[model samples]
Target: MTALMKQNIRRITTVLVSSAMSAFATVQTVGNFSVLSMNTAGLPDFLQGNDVPGDKTENHRMIGAKFVEYGYDIINVQELEFKLNLGQDFNYHAALYSTASLPYRTPTSGGVPFGSGLNTLSRYSFTDTTRVKWNDCSNFGGADCLTPKGFTLVRVLLSSSPEGYAYVDVYNIHADAGVTNADLVARASNLRQLSEYIDNWSAGNAVIIAGDTNSRYTRVRDEIRILTRENGMTDPWVELIRDGVDPTEETICANPTTLSYCETVDKMFYRSSPVLNLQAIGWSYESSRFLQPNGDILSDHNPIVATFSWSLPASLRQSELYGGPHDTWFSDTGVLSRIFSPRISTIRFRGGSRLDAVSVAHVDGTSITHGGTGGRASELKLTDGETWTEAKLCLGQRNNRTGVFAIKARTSAGRTLTAGSSTEDCAEFVAPGGWGIVGFVGGSGSEIDKLGFLFAPH
Candidate 1:
């Protein structure tokens, strides 16, 4: 550690750090998108015209015009089925589909007695679309079994970041209608089936579930809680409009246009993933936008809309982030660390049997630290030309909560640093080809709750 050597190190660190910061500024991803969920009430022309004002064919044209005007990024509509025998030329489904402005859309799952009546329109491209019919249906009060009422799932390509293409699993569902005991039982089964489907198909992915649930938070028999309780989804109406409070009983909206007092069955839910972070920034009931010339309502149920802002790490590439969902998320990019050419200079850890804290210092002299300060402290310093090439983490119960229990870092020069207790549930992350681990991302609080690596070229 001579004076001239220290001066040279500082100069090199400054140049590398500055370059990393500049690169990060160009790759950061942040943007806002909007979604609309509506039940178009696209029943048979005779049945639909009797229930809602105006002709079914004309109403569909009006609804589609509004959808185009609103410019929603994603649109979920239920009861949009068409039956050829019921007058193909005058079908409401065809009228609505023809006027939609969104460039991308899901084709009708089926016709009348067979279709799920669920469709999704989006501004972005989507793939892997699938529709599942509910196993349970109620014939006591509503003819729910006459049609294949169920849900549709689509993986939408939201945007592209340095990490990869950001994708979200969007679900649109229409549950059994009515409030009879048999109907309640059927709706409960519908929600449970959807919960299981999400767990099985959309695991570890960001998701947005919305449509005519035909269930309410205040209704005890709705069982709408299963989506949140079982799958960790957030209801934007409850979170943003209701102030995170569930009304004890059905709330009568004095003015539905305000969107503050209404608890419509048409609802929306969302959940974020380790790769993408989603936050509901705005919500509206959309009462005025869908009105006719004389101010007639569009359908039996008003359209509900939600606006979300998303963000992801600005790294060249990232390993799968691991941990529980109970802490604040952080990324090395927030601290101006470069994810392309930076190298890890030092890694410090504090823990005994469970990792309590982690601190990483880069070649640029900028360091990012996370977690608490309760465990013993240890540090690993890499010499010139040495860099971390692999990381192993054990994720398990710590203080009854899921978190990082152990960590091991191995360098290109063969030096190793280890901490905490290794367990059966362990995951290893290795840099590919000429890449090396240079930074970190994940959730952390009093202890290191989550852990993931960011890679850069040597």
Candidate 2:
């Protein structure tokens, strides 16, 4: 059972090896609060099984100090010391009162915790609070039900928001752990119960649900789907996937080869629009920075955080993205013969001839002129919702002629970038100057889709 605990309980220790992290794309932090979720296996001193078995009260205290130093607005902590009679020895109470003194805090759930070991620290006072233990967890087959693995929900003022939506509902959850059929079923039940609670508690208000979900992103099927697709909550990480990139490439795992290093179980789910005037401007996972003063990760799971700005600008609004106007047409030599080497004269301006929309989208389309000649393109029109700071596109070519795709971006200042003679396609560029024209210059013929993208201005 001890070995099984170590094998299954990932919140006790981290596996981050010393390695420089690779750079990811910069995100625009418009008007969102910084929120975090981590499962701190502070109970059962040997949870991490690294050193002698003894109370790690000091380590837990220091972890709280780290959170204070991070200056985030909200944090959801899981798996703290649950021994009720420990009094002063209780690390959770000490950690909270010690380093987190300045920020407003949530009152610790009273009564013997039954081991929920869950708590939320925030920068604002709670307007409403609700806590409940899972009705589905059990300890007979595994040690899951020993602790009260449940969830907490509260509402706080997003004082930083300019959109007048200061009240935001927040749900902090810790689900059952394991891979057996029983474990999976238990987790599924917990999720359903949580979702139902969300539905019953509020009328689809502005909400952010986060914590150690204990679900794997790589799993073919799991409870996360219920929380996301079915529940209508947006996964910020998924929303931030760069245009034209595979969704799987975006990960909380640092080493994919072994699945041994940094992996993700922590998540943040949110909503924006009619009820919640929040927009997710940025999202990232704590990798290199996932450490304590002693240079080791404070917890086994990497922290995932997202930035939301309620006072978002026109460009950062959610509706600005017009994903699939998918107007497609191509010219082949046989019937729909369209000439090759289309000059700026032939470039198709989305939403009309002037390219006057907030942003334009393009894609290398189905070839028509010949089997591999004329490159086809898609047209796009940008409207409302999330504005961006940059424009990007992907370009492909044929082996017959020199594959050259010409792109022209013209600014209000008349400054222009010309991609007249370049083999380089499939790339990103600053978009202070909105695009004017996109067409093929050389290359026997090339198809282009995802011709343009908009990156929100930070």
Candidate 3:
């Protein structure tokens, strides 16, 4: 019962939907960023060359220099291949070393053509790319939908913090391999058209689904708890398995040919909106380190690496009285909060214009106003048609209940609209775990000085 569990038993189709019971919510551990997903079977029936050993293009350049020796800014791969003229190759160095990419191959051919077996490599700088080929794959991966396996979205950015600019919105998939019946209806139409093409995008941004999920979590049909409780996403080694992932190797190489299989189909999930907070989770299963000078084990699936730490609504803005979030009521606790946490996305509040509209409260004061005739009960105008430079807010309020969040900014002609509070509502909005976008700036005294947040092409 090996060979990747014989690609999941052969024939089973149920679409279960029950798994993710609830557990992982203890975030914050200290991390900057890193992510890597691999399935480098190096397709075209895995170029059998000497039946798996050295020179599989030097084992894909030693697996792309061991993912740059595990530095990883972003790298998702699948069978990967593309051949025009040794230009821009990819996925295990462009399909098992035909050329141009992988482990660390980006000599320009990013135009992505030739064979394109789902490849994404980055050191940062990403955009709105989207690709999902599979129409209705045949069976046992139908030669992997003949070269366009499926799944990719991009977003990336990942840095520049003072309290913002750490974007992410990567999807990267590889579904549709077994359980017959046309591979369970093309893996449920690749999880319902990749959750309806990321459901029109913008939920407070910041998502990272990861890949190679040949569907598990107690199968049923590998609905995978409908993408973690209806696309709320967050698996981190199965719902934060007692301090989730974070392993370089403490011995648990569970199975997949003995290097930590444990039902390995390759997965890694993340989501935020309860105001950004997946601060830690680590992993590495480089299949016992590259090897293969004929020693073996380089790509038959076993790249699996992960590491992350997020929770920086601008490094936790202090909500001011001197340290933010004081709110002394009528007595005026200095009145200047900046709580942070936005994980639903769809935020766009560019430069600034007349200044004065930036309020969305909930440190118990509850706010999300602007329904009609100058609405403002608990406060939440959120740039009500300010047309300042640009405005649009959609913080995760579908049932708001995370913690400490305030966004006060009002003082146009009264003077101070140019001092501090650039209308980004006090922070704390993570917990959606699927959408994408994250960036911020928290410093300015009153009239709202330079504010930010984008990823809302919604």
Q: Which structure is stronger by lDDT: 2 or 3? A: 2
Q: Give per-model TM-scores.
A: 0.66, 0.55, 0.31
Give the per-residue lDDT digits (tens) of candidate 3, residues 1-458.
Answer: 79666655442222222112122222222246777887765542233332454444456666766766656778787655533334333334443344323333323223224444566777777654666566656547455554566777775665533223455678888887777777877787777767766544524455787778677655666575577666677776654453443333333333234434354667877776433455436765666665565556767666666677776442322111111211111111112123233322122121222222233333334332111122122322223222111122221111222211223222211211121122344442221222222233221223222233322111
> Which run of 10 residues does model 1 get worst, by summed lDDT?
332-341
Which segments of model 3 are wrong by more than 4 Å? 1-36, 40-65, 68-70, 76-157, 161-166, 178-181, 195-197, 200-291, 295-297, 301-401, 410-458
lDDT of 1 by residue, 329-352 (tens): 666643433333677789888888
lDDT of every model, 2 decimals: 0.80, 0.51, 0.47
- Can you give the lDDT of residue 190 in candidate 1? 97
Report the C-alpha displacement of residue 190, candidate 3, in angstroms. 1.5
In TM-score terms, which candidate is top? 1
Candidate 2 residues lying further than 4 Å off, grouped into runs, are 1-30, 46-55, 84-90, 110-115, 140-142, 160-165, 241-263, 312-458
